[model samples]
Target: MNNNTQTRTYAYVAAVLYAAIIGLSFLFVKMTVSVAHPIDVLAHRFALSLLVVSIPVIFGWIKIKLTLRDLWRIIPLGLLSPVLFFAFQAFGLVSSNSSEAGIIQAMAPVFTLVLASIFLKERTSIMQKLFLLLSVAGVVFIFLMKGSGMSAGNFKGIALLLLSTVCFAGYGVLARPLAQKYKPMELTWVTLMVGFVVFNAASLIRHVSNGTMMDYVKPLGDASYLGALAYLAILSTMFSTLLASYALTHLEASKMSVFSNLSTLISIAGGAWILHEPVHGYHFIGALLIIAGVLGTNMSGRKRGLVIPDKA
Candidate 1:
């Protein structure tokens, strides 16, 4: 196949995988949160990723080529994308149920579109813009209309979830220029290692201030906790991060962001089946709108047939 055909195939496959990751991530987070504090769990995730990425770096498959400037980029990215985002998300999850959180988190694509428009100056078709509006409206409708039992506490969690979206939206746009220059593996390894360092420091500060240093240390004794940590660290963080970075090399951010809506569907299914959680009509409606919006953006792009400079 020609490069164009090959690239297009990879992009579609990447989109599928992106959706799968987002869907599974909620379950993974839920499991991890059961045993470890969110910060502690995220610390392990990045630490394990740091270890896994070392294999490629040591074997010369990828190299660590960090300059002072590169560290500057990685630091903000680590803070915005992983540290702050996860902290808020984990804390919010402790208060709110997964179903509500999932719907709120699904707003990421809309957030990405708006942020990209401002920071990346990426243009979108009129159809795409309308789709974005519809998706946001759908989320609000879900929150407002869904489930008579929804509480004020759930709304608070949704608020935190929206904050997480903003953090990731900023991360996605800023990451494009960095991802283009650096090999995906290299970028993943470096940024994650930076995250590990930063989060561990923050965790330590929390430990000291809270007089709960032993709480972080105590989880090591429980085999299940350790196992959950290993799964989250290795599978969710290390494996998924590498796969996403690889896919991004072959896909557009807008397309990839749209594909991310799959997470909500996956989370909804997981919630209903695995957690035995209830799903309301509004959740389904909101999810449909979100997915429709995402599809609309991609279809709009193809219809316009305008070439966007590669900012994957």
Candidate 2:
């Protein structure tokens, strides 16, 4: 295959894999946070991810090329994503249901589209804009349906999740330019390292201040908690980020972001099957709109052809 075809193939594959990883991540987040504080979980997840990713680079199996200037440019990308994105998500999940978190995350593409248009100068047709609204309407529909459940705590969680979506969307737009200059592994490694240092330091300070230094390690004992943490650290954080960085190198950020909508369906199903979360009719309806919006927003317009008159 040609280089363009190969890159597009990789982009599509990465998009699918990233979607699946993130879809199932909500379950693990919910599981881990039940026993550990969100900040503690973030610290452990990034620390483990940094360790796993460092092995290859440390052994000379992987070489990452970066100058001080490059580091300065990419640092903001890391801060936007793994640091701010996951921080918001970890805390949001603490107060919100996994299903709600998943649904809210579907809005990331809309944010990405707008950001890409503004920063990357990507064009969006009127239909694409409408479809983006459709996707958002789906989320609003769910919130309204759950009007009775809109406690102040739930509202806070929802707001945090939306903030996380914006951070992640910003990451998508920002990573595209850097992707042109860096290898996926290089970007992923730097971002993971940044998250590791920031989250661990923050957690350490919190633990020391509260005299919960020992409590920070308490969740490590439970096999279930450990398993969940392993998934979040290895698969959800590291692998998914690697996939997303690679995909962004090959695909437009707006198009790549649409793939995130697939996670909503997966999260809803996973929540129902694994967490035994209740599913209402509105969930299905909202999911349908989300799916349609994803499809419509990503669809390419067809060219019109002039037809010659047939001989009589």
Candidate 3:
């Protein structure tokens, strides 16, 4: 096959990998955060990610030529993702339920679609738009079927969650060009470095102020916590970011964003298999909707006989 087709195929695979990693991350996050503060968990996760990515470069097995100027350009992408996205999500879930967070996150495609159109100059056919909405509707239906837990009248929580989606969307849009410009690992390295520095500094500040510096490393003593932290750092944060960057190199931001809905289905499956959560009838139905919507969104609208690319 041709290079473009080959690249496109790899892009979709990367998108799927990113989605699956992110989908399973909720499970891992639960494992890590149970024994440590959320901030501390984030700190450890990024610290590990940065260390892992930096090793290849330090060992002369990989090469990167990032200057201060490159960091300035890439910093916005970093801010949009691991830093702001996680912060809003951690705090947002504090006041809202999983169902609510699910519904809010499903709108990430809509956010990317709009941002890509305005900022990235990407276009979509009418059918693609409908399919996108259908996918979103599936996610909403699944979450709404989840029913009310504690009502969230807390405007703060809702706002933060919305901001989280926006940041992710913005990252997808902004990263598309940068992904094409830099090697995937280069972008992933910067992202991890920024997250590592920001989160660790924040954790350090919190510890200093509260005289809880001793408690920071206290979580590392647990074997389970260490396992969970490793998964999050190595797979979720580092590998997922690399996959996303690689996909963005060949896919449009708008197309890449829709794959996020697949994660909802993955999350459900993970819960059922690992957490022993019951798989309700609604889940099967919602899963069908999600799968159809994703397929349709990708397959239905092709101006030049090509579906757009999108992801987490």
lDDT, candidate 2, 1-312, per-residue tens: 986667678778899899889988998899999999999999999999999998999999999888999888889999998999999999999899888888888888888988988998877677777887787788678767866477899889989999999998999999987886788898999899899999999999999999889988998999999999999999999999899988888777887888888787788888899999888999889888887887777664312321111111
Q: Could you give candidate 1's per-residue lDDT for residues 144-197 as a string of tens digits?
A: 775536478766766777788777667677676666676676667766777789
TM-score of 1: 0.87
Q: List the residue pairs that clash in candidate 2.
A: none
Instruction: Give me the displacement of residue 16 in model 2, in angstroms.
Output: 1.6
Full candidate order by lDDT, most accurate first: 2, 3, 1
Give residue 232's lDDT in candidate 3 (0 to 100).
90
Cα RMSD to the true fold for all candidates: 2.7, 6.0, 2.8
TM-score of model 3 vs. true structure: 0.92
Better candidate number, 1 or 2, judged by lDDT: 2
Measured by TM-score, the strongest candidate is 3
Residue 203 in model 2: lDDT: 93
Off by over 4 Å in 1: 59-61, 134-141, 148-152, 209-211, 280-286, 303-305
Per-residue lDDT over 1-312 for candidate 3, one digit per residue giving the tens place of the 0 to 100 score: 887778789988999888888777765665565688889999999999899999999999999998999989999899989999987876775665444555577689999999999987788889989999889888877767866554455567668878988998999999998997889999999888889989999999999999999999999999989998999999989999989998898888888889988877776777667656566788778878877878888777677734444332
